[model samples]
Target: MKKSLLIIALAISIISCNKETQTTEAAAFKTAYIDTSKLMEEYTEAKDVAAKYKSKSDEAARKLEVQEANFKSDANYFQKNAQANGQAWAQQKGAELQQRQQQLQYAAQTMAQQLQEGHAVEMDTLVKSVKKFIKDYGKEKGYDYVYGTGDAASVLYAKDSYDITDEVVKLLNDKYTTSAKKEETTETKKEEKK
Candidate 1:
């Protein structure tokens, strides 16, 4: 009888220990997604500026294309009329045309380089801001691991329910809003003091 009781006690102890461990693990861990795309879209000023620069560059390219077409038409007209007028005048005009083309090319190249440089600067600044936010978020929230989709090897196929993108955005908006309110109050106090 005592032997049977001992076996049952040992089994209960093992089962209870396992249950405790499982409970502790369950309480300690959770999986979630940050949906970085949403955050970048929402808070990224650099991305916005880069987009503007790209639009401007595209516009400049289109304008240059129109100018090139006009130049081609003018060149054709000049070539057709060159036989009637002195080749000297046409030659002079051709040299002038070449100068104009060189100037346009230089301008286009400069604008393109400007766009590229601006985009690089904006992206670098954005990356720094995002990294700082993520680092602070991890520290503030006690996240064991905060992974981004940029890591293609992992973090694939997370369900929408597990995503905390909206939550994080909302939290940030609230924090900023509250800070703005506090600043406004401080400004009002200063005005009163004055």
Candidate 2:
């Protein structure tokens, strides 16, 4: 009876140890990280957005440049004819030129402010979209933690095997391309219907 009791106790202890090992294995977390800078650099949507904004900025600058050139020309002409045009005429023209300058300055400031606001909003949306994508990706891939590494590195060290930047970039670009193609096809169908 004593030997039998000891054997039963040993069996119970072994079963408990097996259960703990299984629990430990199941509790292990899967972690990965992405290089944010590389992701942004390689992301087609990001590149396209950047180019679009740059074009808008360039167009605004060109319009402002033309206006400035015209203003400068008028100012030069007024200066050359100030004495010939008489004191009253000179004073009036000077005031007009000053007002025009002020208008130009206001226009420049407004354009800059508008562009900055628009770009900031667009960038914010893009960032949020990327973050959501990453979160969804982690969930889909059974990852418990997904870290971002950039100029401001949140992760101190990680193995290269854990870097998913390239994979994420490829998936993002593929999705962007597919969506773009769908949009183009939809537009073409609309045009045909019209």
Candidate 3:
């Protein structure tokens, strides 16, 4: 009877110890908050990318306007020259203009596609760079979890000390700078080759 009681007591003690350890572990777990809005606002690469695409789109619009004017002028010219070829001449000029317009439309569509594709590439690259930085940052800091405060999700309550936003922002900026330098170097080399 005494031995059985002792065994039961020991088991209870062990269970109690385990519970305490788990509670301590849970309490010690750290949560870090990252402000993605601030990072995005300060991000240079994103701005640069936007500017590039905006300029390209503007150029496309100007080219389209010029093309429209040329088309109108060509149509007028064809109308004036229709008397020379008699009946079929009008149809021939219209057909030629139609073919040329179709070709221009195809080219414009292709340019728009390329612009979209370029934007996608830039976004993917930027996102990948951020994820990579996060991975490295987490590893280096021994972070239990880093909570991203994207625009949709509000961080209602986070301790100022636990905010890793600045650290992450720095890492993102550094990565962007490195990649930009590499791209510039590559462009310079290509230009030299040309």
Candidate 4:
């Protein structure tokens, strides 16, 4: 009777232990990480944003360059004719050139600041979009945690198998392409209507 009771108790404990193990396994958290630098580099939307800003910067630079060239030409003309134009005229013209220079400088500074602010706003929007996308992806994929690794890496090390950067980038690009196509189609339809 004693041996049988001992056997029954052992069996009960074994069953309980097995049940606990199974529960623990089932409750294990699923985690993954992304290489943000790679994601940004590969993401089509990010690249497009960068290209758009670059184009804007280039255009602004070209405008400034033209203005600068004109200013230089005017200054050269003034210098060449300063003495021949007489002291009073030279001083007046010199003041005018100085005013022009100040205006040019102000314009350049304003343009640069506007571009910088616009770029910053766009980048902030892009980052927020990406973060929200990642959050939604994590929930959809049953990921308990999705860490980021980049210039300001939150994750120090993760196995390559656990990296989802490529997957995220691919999905983001596909979404962007689909949206872009839809926009183009909508525009084309509007144009046709016209």
RMSD of each: 6.3, 4.9, 4.8, 4.6
- Alpha-carbon runs more than 4 Å astray in model 1: 1-27, 44-47, 58-77, 150-153, 171-194
Ranking by TM-score: 4, 2, 3, 1
Quote model 3's TM-score.
Answer: 0.71
Q: Write down the TM-score of every candidate.
A: 0.62, 0.86, 0.71, 0.87
Which of the numbered candidates is closest to the native, going by highest TM-score? 4
lDDT digits (tens) for residues 62-180 of candidate 3: 99879878988998898888888787878888899999889789878998999999989997887787777787788788888877786855677788888888877777778879988
lDDT of 2 by residue, 25-86 (tens): 87788999999999998899999888988999999999999999999999999999999989
Better of 2 and 3 by TM-score: 2
Model 2 whole-model lDDT (C-alpha atoms):
0.95
- Across 104-169, the per-residue lDDT of candidate 4 in tens digits comes to 999999988998999889989999999999999999999999999998899988888999999999
Clashes of each: 0, 0, 0, 0
Worst lDDT window (10 residues) for model 4? 22-31
Give the Cα-based TM-score of candidate 1 against the true structure: 0.62
Model 3: lowest-lDDT 10 consecutive positions: 148-157
Model 2, which residues run further than 4 Å from truth? 1-27
